[model samples]
Target: MSFTLKPRNGLPYAIATRLPRFPFALILLPMLLAGCEAELNLAAVSQETSHASLRTDHYQALASNEAVSVLVGNDGVVLVSPDQGLTWQRQQLPGKPGLIDVDACPDGSFIALGFDNRLWHSADQGQSWNVHALPTEEQMLTATCAPGGAWWAAGGLTTLLGSQDQGASWDTTSLDEDAMLTTLQFLDADQAVVTGEFGLVFNSTDAGQSWQASGNLPDEFYPHTSHFVSLDEGWVGGLNGFIYHTVDGGQSWQRQDTPSTAPIFNFSANRDGLFAIGDHSSVLHLSGERWQTVPTPNAPVYLRAASSGDDHRLTVAGGRGLLLNLDTRPALAAQAQ
Candidate 1:
């Protein structure tokens, strides 16, 4: 089981623990506490901080718009890069909360999730942030902004949340299920999908007002990353190198061949094309008729988040502050040059 260190009674030195899916993450606890041996430094993370330095923080999610990108993860850490991934500035929330997911809105804003029933918003790329309370404390796992300017999030105990005033308030929905919702995506302004444990898949055409079961993923499947090109077409990747494609809006599935068994973490698309990143430094791109593996600069580490840039580049981030800007052009284009 994985181990996570959460604030104990809002104090720096106190320790709270939880078991997670990825046992490999157990090592990250020591890495997070490396610099400060005396006690946990909560204030050091909350203040307005910026530095052109490499961090050993565990980055979990990402959001982007054009040249601006933000990465958030363990210890309330938020890293912003205005020029794609060329440079970065770091900021942290008060309390060193673990941020699980981040999504960019249609109006150039961003929304990030914390496990403590809180949401953080940034209107100026990542220069600053405002925190708001969510309606439930179910440990929101995934978040996304619809093309129509609505915020949606889901997590444990089949909890679902939606907001219109940018988290000023929220509307909560429960599916009455016992599974954890792990991933979500908006196909457009109206259609959206949510997938999670027990292979559950639910679709909503009338925004978040209603949902209907579409299909079930492979038995016992736990989705970690999902990307939908349309309401009727998408891809979901998970542990053991499993990748499935659904062209009929999740009603049916076709297993796709992946290059490795590394757990997939994130998927993104842009003008250049669609891409996926994960553990083992795995980066895969859609090449014509199949998924092709791409090389990474670092050793195997969990690559958890990615977002496309204006210049046809993909900014990737994950374990131990791993970040990179990858060229998205097809192989043939480089070979012909």
Candidate 2:
């Protein structure tokens, strides 16, 4: 379970409690007490916030806002939390399709992609769904909705589709086959980029109307996720622990180093920095230009996706119900066994 509060203008923080949850603690000492006494009690209060760890089936994707958080995964399994993930309920969807990725819109709607290369939409926060077909049959890996009422989907073997009518239908763009397309991101109403297997990265300028092949590095780099903080600066992470950075709007790229060689399945970005999560206990962090490692929990699941909201809280979702929240405040831990 998770808790959501309206965010103040503070640094973005994500905290993922480990295998056994610590009591989530945000110390607020009562002012009515003697000042000296309250100061001493503050430390003790932080020790009492522990509760049961949230348990559920393996999760594949997560999305959220100030009010709702949704986790989707295999067998049409969906969990929705109204209170910023502090509480959850099983949300019944229409099909048993293996859900691959999900995107939450600003207007309380949700869109999901799956194994069959189809798009599913829910107006009621994942309680039900309906399918929207793409232009191709390649397995749809990732999708996003733009602010200007357009939707885009990218997937295997050079498959790219664009929808102008909010995904009622899609048109096949001319950027045809080379490798498996894995991820897509729209920087704004007019610009977008797509990445895939064989180190393929494509850029679009006219609202995905056309494309330009920009980055083609080593053959093994399959960029599964991409995040752009600005129109010029961005990063892509994928298989073989691959991470590439670009500054001139994909004009050129450079590699970043991390200790773990595990595949980086996904990334989430906010005002604070960039964070990537993946297999083999790998969490690569970028605060400025230099990259570092953020240790992850000892769960046996590849963290597949992350959603960073406007608030500082970041929710990372993966297999075996691996949900980790990394934040600034200290969570109350069990007193060392």
Q: Count the backbone clashes (under 3 Å) in each candidate.
A: 0, 15
Which digits, one per residue and each the tens of the lDDT, describe model 2 over residues 1-337? Answer: 3423232111111132321111011111111111110111122111101222233344567877556777777666677767555556775456566676788765668888765667888788777788886768555667777657667787655777878777767787646765567678777778887776666777878888888887564544656677876657778875556688888866677888655566676788665567787774345566455555554454445667577766555566665456666541221121111
Models 1 onward score TM values of 0.83, 0.76
Regions of model 1 farther than 4 Å from truth: 1-53, 330-337
Candidate with the greatest lDDT versus the true structure:
1
How far residue 243's Cα lies from its native spot in candidate 2, in Å, is 1.7
Any idea what lDDT model 2 has? 0.61
Task: Please provide, for model 1 over 1-337, each residue's C-alpha lDDT reduced to its tens digit, 9 standing for 90 to 100.
Answer: 2234445322112122432332224223321101111222122111112454244576778888764878887778888888776678878788887787888899999999876668888898878889888888575777889999998889877789999888887899988887778888888888888988778899899987898888888775778778887878889987765789999988888888665666667788877677777775667766653566655553455777788765666777766556776666543243224
